[model samples]
Target: AQRVTQPEKLLSVFKGAPVELKCNYSYSGSPELFWYVQYSRQRLQLLLRHISRESIKGFTADLNKGETSFHLKKPFAQEEDSAMYYCALINGNEKLTFGTGTRLTIIP
Candidate 1:
């Protein structure tokens, strides 16, 4: 069995501050890691994936297989960036397992 863990349930930061969301996973085999965000009254969308090596909304995450962690980071935080972020993992069976999620609040 695989599981995703997000230790933080809520994160608040002032505008222009850096943001880092912690994510850790446990699985026996290789897994695909991803970060997804959901804004106010909006549907969940993909932020980035380890394999793609791309950055979205100024956010990026790197998969550390040895550490079994994938942490999302942003150089600067903006008000619009406030949202619910979820770290997920795709299992060998193609099933997506998501963490409880973190609510990010960017203050002015």
Candidate 2:
């Protein structure tokens, strides 16, 4: 099973509020999970990876092997953080499977 799921299509958050974007995956082997963000008309770029254990643009994600989940989080939502986010899974040599994505809007 190689699949990535993002349940939310759109998320609205006020500035300075915490935000969370959920992601779930299913794979047979050790899979790599990634979060990609696309701002407006810009191309999609890698936001963070489960293996990196780092944060990008104030966003962080922790991979929970026990629950098989990788949920992106930010302590304070900013206007720039508002974008289309996609959860992806890479299983072995198989192609990357991406979720439909979630559009986040930060209301000032």
Candidate 3:
């Protein structure tokens, strides 16, 4: 079975501090990883995906096969960045699994 785990349920950082949301997965075959963010009163949106190799909102994540991890990182945190982040994975069968999610809070 494929699964996604987000170690942190709640994370807080200073306005300009670095932010990292840990994500680990368990799967037998190659899976597609994604980071989804949901802002206040907004719908869930895609932040980034491993295959794209792109950075969004100053945040980037690298898929480490050996570690089976895809942790999201941002050099500097912004107040607007505060939101609920979910790590998800989809297997070859197109079955999607999501983590419990992490709520990020930015403190001034």
Give candidate 1's whole-model lDDT. 0.95
Q: How do the residues 1-108 of candidate 2 rate in per-residue lDDT, one tens digit apiece?
A: 688889999999999999999998888788899999999999999999889999899999998888889999999999998899999998777688999999999999
- Where does candidate 2 clash, by residue pair? none
lDDT of 3 by residue, 1-108 (tens): 888999999999999999999999999998899999999999999999999999999999999999999999999999999999999999877777999999999998
Report every candidate's CA lDDT: 0.95, 0.93, 0.95
Residue 97 C-alpha lDDT in model 1: 99
Kindly state the number of residue pairs that clash in model 2: 0
The candidate, 2 or 3, that scores higher on lDDT is 3
Q: What is the lDDT of residue 68 in candidate 2?
A: 86
Quote model 3's TM-score: 0.98
**Tens-place lDDT digits, model 1, residues 1-108:** 899999999999999999999999999998899999999999999889999999998999999988999999999999999999999999878899999999999999
Error of 1 at 86 (Å): 0.5
Report how far off residue 32 is in candidate 3 (Å): 0.9
Model 2's TM-score against the true structure: 0.96
